[model samples]
Target: MTTIEKALIRLHEVDAQSRGDFLLQTLDARAKVIVTIAYIAVVLSFSLTSFSGILLFAVFPIVSASMSGISYGQVFLRSMIALPFIAFVGIFNPIFEREPMLVAGDLTISRGWVEFLSIMLRGVLTVQAALLLIASTGFQRVCRALGCLGVPQIFTTQLMLIYRYIYVLINEAIRMDRARRSRSYGRRHYDLSMWATFVGQLLVRSVGRAERIHRAMLARGFDGHVRILGHLRWSSTDTAYCILWIGLFIAGRFFDLSSVLKFL
Candidate 1:
């Protein structure tokens, strides 16, 4: 099969796999949205100094990923892509504060190190939670949920449009790359010039495609907003899930389960 066909097939397979997951299908759009928001809030509220607390909190993503049937490897790949920015923000914490704040046996660790580690852990947990949410709920449900949560209409509409068009752009890029490889076979190694040319051509084509998409939208009477066809009604299952997680978060924070574990 052609590269374009292969890309399309892979995309469809992913969509199918996501659909086959029972836990993902159980939550309606609103429920998924609420769960995602609540999960993030709970993860963020933990104290940085509480190592055991963070470790206990970490169970949610692992369990969710398994239950949702999403590939942990795929989630890790996405997380790695975004880690640098997060690391950059947290790396400085360890540099500025060097005083020893805690003693574990004979080893002393700086307060800054604890803070930095916390920041890094927070970033990873937050990002992974988001990725899992999107992988399970799908992007359309997320956009709709955002809309329901009172995010500005314009922002949600743009998000929807960009997400919808991203596959088209990726397919176009793959097609262009294939064409280049076909013609360049048996030729000298590709240099910077060839690389720049390919990227520039892709950008130009993407812009043209965007223009055509805008015209298509206009023709369809799109009035600067996307209208989802269905309404999301929250069920009892969603409420239970939300309450359970929120309760665990509260318990974890106040009781310091991690410290208790170490004591035992």
Candidate 2:
């Protein structure tokens, strides 16, 4: 199978996770989205030097994965996609801020290093929380929930469009790739020139395809708004779930539970 085919398969597998009959899958998307946002806010609010406090927040993802029946390994691997950019953002912290924050006997640790690690942790946690939210609640539901939460209609509609057509984009790419291979005559590798030509072809084809798709949608009475199928009702269970998670997040953010336990 081609690499693009593999990518499409991987995408389908990830999407399938959101459709399972798991605990999180059954919750209201609005509640899950709200709690995920609250959790991210709490995570970002932590001080750079509060490494221990951030460590404590790791429990949220762990417990969430356990309750939702999501695989930590898969989530962790997917979350690593953001690591390179996160590293780029903080790579210079150690060089710019060298004040010592910790002393272990003869060894000294710099504040910049701590802050860099803290930033990395924060980025990973936030990204993973979002991934979990998407895995538990499908992207369409999340977009609908965002619409209900008063987000601008255009933004939500664009998100839904991008997500819904990603498969079409991939399938188109696969077809183009197969055509390329068939005509490449014994050449299996693409040089820079070939890659450029391939990209140009794909772009032209995509634009034409998009125009046809828009026309078809208009012919079928397409409106500006995306129409989702199900109703999103906020039940008592959703309220309780939101309250429990957000309350925990607030307590963790302000209380410094790690220090309290030490005093006890």
Q: Residue-wise lDDT of candidate 2 within 129-196, one digit each (tens)?
A: 99899888888889899999999999999998888788998898888788989998867778999899
**Alpha-carbon error at 212 in model 1, in Å?**
4.2
> Scored by CA lDDT, what does every candidate get?
0.75, 0.88
Question: lDDT, candidate 1, residue 140?
Answer: 72
* Candidate 2: 10-residue stretch with minimal lDDT: 221-230
What is residue 93's positional error in candidate 2, in angstroms?
1.8
lDDT of 1 by residue, 1-264 (tens): 555567677556546655764776567767766766777887788776655577687777887777788777777666766668877887887798888988989999898888877777777777887777776777677778888889898998888887677678778877776777689875544589988988898889888987997899899997876777878778888888778877877787678787677766
- Spell out the clash pairs found in candidate 1: none
Off by over 4 Å in 1: 1-17, 71-78, 182-200, 207-225
TM-score of 1: 0.78
